[model samples]
Target: MAGWMNLVNEWLVPALVLSSLAAHLVVVVLAAVRRREASGWPRAILWLANQAADLAATQTLGNLFLGSTSREKHLVAFWVSFLLIHMGRPDNISAYSMEDSVLSARSVIEAIFQIAGAIYVLIKHIIIGGGGGGDGRTFVLASITMFLVGIVKYAERIGALWLGDLGSIQSSGKKLKRASLSVGHLEISDDEQALQAAHRLLHITKGAFADYSSDEVEHKSSHANDEQARLAAARRLLHIARGTFADGNDNGSRWSWSQGWEQLFRLVEMELSLMYDVLYTKAAVIHTWHGYCIRFASLHFTAIAFWLFSLSSKDGYRWSDVYITYLLLIVTFLLEVRWLLSALASTWTYAFLINTNSGLRHAALCSGRWRRLRRFVMSLDLCRLALVRDPSSYRMWSGKIGQYNLLSECTHDMTSFYRTLAQRFGSEDSWKEYKYCYSGVLHISSPVRNILFNNIWDKLKLAYKPEEMRAMAAMPVPHDNDARRRNKLDKALRFAPELQDYILTYHLATDIFLQCSGQKGAACAFVKTIEVLSNYMLFLSVVRPYMLPGLKIHSLYTATRDALHDIW
Candidate 1:
């Protein structure tokens, strides 16, 4: 019976912990994979797998000291290192959503509990069987070093959690003060063509939005180019329509983009990078000087401690424990390597290398080759088929942009799905299968944004009021508001000098355009495209108010939402 119990302690328990540890290590590798251009389901599966492995490893470590008499000192030290390694999550991913940051308090509490558990396990091991695998003093000191490293890494995550919240950004006294200083000024960048253009336009629109002399804003821009101005204004409207309110503050909001919408594909490329930063990367601090410091410290400490453990004698320990320790050491260093590679592969790294004369930039020497490499590394096909989705998929993750459908908006929400309407309402005699569903792909070389931006810019130029033009321009302006009528109320509202009215009015006009055009020619298809995109923008404004520039739309959106809900 004593022999049997020893066998259980020597093999069974270690095997369980090994399984958990192996699962955790595999997740650390698998999580490195990015399927941004791939379908959404694969990413979701990978994320779930990583989370499960994390929980399992934590539980198994706790079980190490639970009522059992198998107190191995080396096992305790390995446990400390595992805890630290897990805390150093993939560089690209922090909280999966804004809500994750909100609930991060729970994670903080759990970390505290785990820390306490580690303390208990260490104490219990000392009382039971003594030092891990070497001289008592040496093992204790080694364990302490790894523990401190883990604690520091864990603390960084807690800080990230506290700061990553949308509410937190608004609440941070430090960040808010910095943001307040820039509200009235344009954030210019010569490196980012669209952002530079937007900066100039922001100067003019900032005045229209609030209190500023348009003359002073224009005077400051006497040296700026007009092409940047046009492209910026167009891209800004697109960002507004898409629910990406990139800037915020006391003075006003500014939108920035690296590529102009005129080239089209470049905007798509840059959009992918920006979305990744906001959604996954810790854009808040990971690229900062302090971020680099913490990463270097964590890496060096982990590698050093792992080397010490690798060199220590392993005689007195069970064979299973010895094997597991070797495995842990190998995994720790491998993860560090993977982490470094991920940091290099980030968009922030690319920007940093471009802006500086860092000797590390030889990898990206040729611009054309660099772009091709970027597309291959950065793009992923995010396909969540609208026609074949379950309700659960919608609840799993909330994107920066909510889903939209023009046909559904014509009716009540949740009462029906849009594809059903397309099928049921169609003229069956014309063709057999008429199916329309919207599944967005993130990495297509589509020029749809460029088309939309130019069209909107032209409309704004045509609709500019006399005083508005005189106020915004450095010289006399052209008068071009003589276009034919299309419901004066809608026309006036659509072309109103205010940006908000443009968002609302265009939504209404598209519906009217669709009703009048009928579903036939090339004209109909073009009108239909405008209608869907335009109405979707309005739907986004209503459903996702936070993503819009700070504005008052409760009553208007409520009425629109109520009407849509009824039809839905």
Candidate 2:
């Protein structure tokens, strides 16, 4: 046993130390070669220095174990090796040129302790004379110091891991909160407003659907049967109109704000899922990179463990050496576990991307189905309108002519005012003046008109005053001497309220649909339709005197004067 121990101590330990040094040198050389094309030379110098230190340490360890008469040489080599280890430490190495005072202080303290320990080991080695002659107490103290250093290094690694986890959790929570707020604030109320908006939306939707449907039908008809294409087109339009009306219901209605929020949240979630899928794909790539790092680290750790084991086993392994081997094994185990987790994460991320892509495709299909249904409803409505001979035949048609007459008178008054203004002013200047006048009249009269005739009566309740705020309101509103002509206008401006409302609703609905179709030409057509409708209403008003009852010419004249004044 003593002979075997002597052979291990004198030969095996020194050989193993040399092998470890050679391996380290090879690694440093490879690192240098790989980084040769790097922008800077400092990294290459550092790696070269590390390799030199490793070689020195290997030589010193081998010579010390072999009882070489070169204490100064061993000490110098040991110091160099220690310095290299300290430099490799994450906290000890700074990316910038500026030294970190706290890290420097810690390093100095560590170096002091290491130097003291090295001195004690040297003294014990000198007394041993090639035999393990140190007192157990000295060995224990040395082991304790080494253990403490390992603990510090491990604690630092753990802290970094915890901090990363905390940051990820915080970021995830903030994203969720933002998504929640976006959904919470997207509610709409006021049925009248909703109905008006819906009508407008419907008009736009119908117009867009019609144009697209016509084109699609023409294309289909040219290739196939025209009758079938026409039928399909009609069905598509009707479906679109119905869907638009259904979708336009305000949140306050049966659909509710909660439902809208739920839908929007679902959309956001779906979008997030897609984003996550992309991130997952990226993470997979990152994981692959990390895997390579893990494999490299594992190889180094394995080499270190084997080398340490070889030395300790040869030199009559002490408790300290055994503990270090265990620690190295622990490090290797951790690296293996981390590598496994990274690989799993990469696999999971790839699966997630695939699933998300499928889900997105499904969502697109659902959207297309919904749009098709909406188009079908619109086509049905259009067909019904086409079949009707008189506007009065429709359910929304009002037989009363008083409203029409009233509107007609109002139109005529506006035209006459425009004509007079144009004659008095140059055509170019008059046109500008007319636009401003119309814009102002529309802006002011819109609220009043909406309140008096539409469902905005409740909103105007606070605006009503006992002649106190009336002055203020009156100040904002332009006055006209034609107020006395109200009786004459009431009789002249008669029209069917239901019919007018229906026409306006249809027009608005068509416009809304057109906007949704994402067609620029359809949008232009909708705008043109609105302008034409406004002009037609004005023309009808101009001819009010020849139309129905309840429209007073005098009252309409007063309203026109006020409208023009408000416009200006």
Best by TM-score, which number? 1
lDDT, model 2: 0.33
Per-residue CA lDDT of model 2 for 192-284, tens digit only, reads: 222223322222222221223211212111121222222332333323322222323332222222233223222222222222222111222
Count clashing residue pairs per candidate. Answer: 16, 76
Instruction: Supply the TM-score for candidate 2.
Output: 0.19
- What shift in Å separates residue 465 of candidate 1 from its native position after superposition? 8.4
- Candidate 1: Cα lDDT at 322: 71
The lDDT for every candidate, in the order shown, is: 0.47, 0.33
Cα lDDT for residue 320, candidate 1: 67
Q: Each prediction's TM-score against the native?
A: 0.56, 0.19
| Deviating ranges (above 4 Å) for candidate 1 | 1-39, 69-73, 103-106, 126-128, 132-141, 172-260, 263-279, 316-318, 341-449, 459-568
